[model samples]
Target: MEEPIRILYVINALEVGGTEGQLAELISGIEKERFSPYVCCLRTIKDKSSYSLDCPIIALGVSRLMSLQTLIGMLSLVRYLNHNRIAIVQTFFIEGTILGVVAAKLAKSVSAIVVSKRDLGFMLTKRVIWQLKLIYHFADRFLANSKNVKDYLIKKEGVNRGRIDVIYNGIDIEALEKKMQEVSGADIRSREGIPEHVSIVGICANLNRKVKRVDLFLMAAAIVCKYLKDVFFVIIGEGCLKKSLLDLSEHLKIDLKTRFVGSQVNPIPFIRMFSVGVISSDSEGFSNSIMEYMGCGVPVVATDVGGNRELVEDGVTGLLVPCGDAEKMAEAIQVFLDQPAFRKKAGEEGKKVLLERFAKNKMIRDHEFYYASLTKEKRMAFKKKRGKFSA
Candidate 1:
């Protein structure tokens, strides 16, 4: 029998977010013959149902912060690694990253623990800094979602630059395009009560202060309404700040055009109906929504932050503007809306970038290769050290 590759993946929770979605894509895409995968969730599932995946998923129910329950959950994860003999341990987000790496060491099943950094400055903090440093000391490697994130880790936390590798979050282009093409956005708009003739501006954000600036999205929409007629704004995803955003939009006097089209079974339906997808985020690592919009053949007018520039080539693919500059954001979106030819050109160009750079298959293959390399290196070193000790 051939030796199967066993991978233990730890994530905070497999909720509806970019990092979680990326994990789903990778696990589904991996060649199961060469690799066997298992997952450990740091917290309980909100839905109270087992998640369906190609690999088995374990939930530790680590609900509290710095508690005995959390420690016990970490130990349970450690025991699983020991029992399964997990070779390479990979983690996502901050809290999981800290616990997973340390537990992997305790289990003695982890040769190389890889941490995927999602955001730079905001994601890291002084509270977790010591834990991160401890993980850094014991872990074999650190993998960043992008070069920008690697720069952040090195500059902010003083992580060893040589140990860090940059791997972009992989996007599934064919699936995204097919999903978009099969959608009936016309009916979706009708059901959402948005008229067909109105200019629709879409935002894929949960109203929040730290990440997606729902406030900025509303403000930009207010300015866009001044010049454009029959404009309607669509905000997707649900968050704590949803009600506050609606109130502010009403205060701006564009409440008529504002529609709080909350979370959907399929956001692609709403995403395709719009003339353009609006991103007014103050921070991002790599934007899945921005790429998803482009994949749907819709141009984006996003704030110039994180990997937004890597996806949106200002004026070519779609316009990029300074963060919080509502006037410039409105100007760019208006320009795309005014010129039909420009809209066509920008959308097509953006799609080209997604196909070439963000293909999901490429992302999967890179991880497969990385896993092989790390495992192979560990085995070789193990044999060498054993031989020396015996002699």
Candidate 2:
């Protein structure tokens, strides 16, 4: 009977990274009756991995930072927010949050601004950090993908602790189960020229040496190869460090056993192929791959960093090795490879954890509730100001 509350979801781009993928999933999951969602990408759609949502998408075609074109794009965003009378503006990533919050303030569109901290901000440049420090106070609320991220924002970036809310990433367990049933790991292995007898250890993350420590994963893989025969490794993502990582694999003499399956649109089949799932990141905000591994009944071996300890109970769900120790990582991976019963036990326990904590429906409900509550608070504040003016 009444008009739905309009919300704009803004991000740096509609690319296939974890943050972008989560944005797509969250927007797609929102109930249409309660909210009219719109998407605004700071850059043009460079890849085909974007979501085809029912709502309109406005791509500003921003390619460079701090350029004339970026300024034009920000102005365009401000105008759009004012014209559409968007009730809420939620942003992901550093670029989008900085720009989105600035635009929201400039437009004075009566919108509740929410920003998400999806990573540890280890990869953020100095310029972006400066901007964040300046504009973070303009945001009404902050959403962090993990408690680790929230603490980092508060302790490192000097953001108010009370303003940040920790929300773990969620997985669509039903959809994931359907995909796993539809695509067998053997089918994928056969197509990729991998032998069925080999034990596959795979990681699905953007290849970055500094952040993801993918080189460390490769090092561990090489170590595992010496003690265990008939084993293979797979890295399922693309990034700037691909060339160097490939070289490192060759240098380590594990090139023959490793496969770099560059950027997959649907990496679930690849993830399903793993005997062990690994997160070697130097830092992480809650790991989507860890959830995916557990969902597929695969045990994980992750470095004890970020929210990894939150998701994995060492020796229960999987093993946790110290960050940057290849020998320790190899030892943990070998434990799963050698003991089938232990792997199965750990995997089943991991699945139970996923079902109990990281379900998609619960995430969607939490987001919807947060949005509604913020908008209500904003409205009440506005009403109070109006009452004072009238009196």
Candidate 3:
């Protein structure tokens, strides 16, 4: 029997965010009999216990980008890849993509290099784009989480259409269902001092980045408050911009009805409390928050942006509005609030769409097939080269 292929996944950190959570879920759910998974972090992991993985995780202890430690870490990564005969090196985020691709190219035994693109490059600068373009030549394949991202790579970055594969982020429905069963929405509302009868419009996103456009959520919430007195707005997830967002909420006079429940390890309960789920991001690769909202049977009101349209069925499952248009967003939210039956039906349809299209098993199977095919092609190319030499 052939030995299982060894694939090393590299990332910036194991933080409690969409990218990290997706990585954890993929590694944990991947078929161990066919692929042996390992993880590498460019920096030290702060909370190792948060992820449940049996495979080894190596931290290179990189303190800064321009330091000698980063150089040493890169060399160490190459050595590890060569010594372990890594079949594939898969990288996430910018730092991981640049460093991992370079190291994988240097490693003699590495067969393939994959770069995961999860966002729309809203934060990338000209210098960073040039750097990424230089490194793109060494990578064997690119994994985009959405067609919107794939199109961006081809049209914006000059990548060939054949080189990119669109793999939508998957949700572990079983685990999500289990979490929903375990967590009580009533308990969470009580703890947060939210009244039982009030309608809740909520958003789950980090406030650190301006690209999330959380200000739009607050503005829309304030608009909703104008017509409805029995509604509350909730923001889940915390970052440096918390103070500024709070000030904005206060200025809008919606602070009295808003709850900023900081970062949550398990936000399912909070999601359960939402009468409507909202995503006000200026861009998205694919939103895990939208999936969570659908999984919890809560209808979504999202900006019509990257990958969002793919997940939301406009008038059927959820409503889509223009990015940065708070009034339009508020209008959509109001539509859901006014018609409970419509909201409930939309939520149900969203969940059905999620189950049919974005289940965990489907994602795992797709990845397994992709990895196996790449490695097989690599082996065939090597054999053909050897045959030519012999002839």
The lDDT of each candidate is 0.83, 0.86, 0.92
Clashing pairs in 2: none
Report RMSD for candidate 2. Answer: 1.9
Tell me which residue pairs clash in candidate 1: 171-360
- The parts of candidate 2 lying over 4 Å away from their true place are 46-49
Q: Compared with the true structure, what per-residue lDDT tens digits does model 2 show for residues 176-240?
A: 88877666887888877899889899998877546888999999998998988889999998888
Question: Which of the two candidates, 2 or 3, achieves a greater lDDT against the reference?
Answer: 3
> Residue 139 of candidate 2: its Cα lDDT?
84
Q: Which portions of model 1 miss their true places by more than 4 Å?
A: 46-51, 181-183, 208-210, 383-391
Superior by lDDT: candidate 1 or candidate 2: 2
TM per model?
A: 0.94, 0.94, 0.98
**Against the correct fold, how does model 2 do in TM-score?**
0.94
- Model 3 weakest 10-residue run by lDDT: 180-189
lDDT of 2 at 119: 76
lDDT sort, best first? 3, 2, 1
lDDT of candidate 3 over 80-187, digit per residue (tens): 998888989999999998889999999998999999998889989989899999999999999999999999999877788898998888999889988886768788
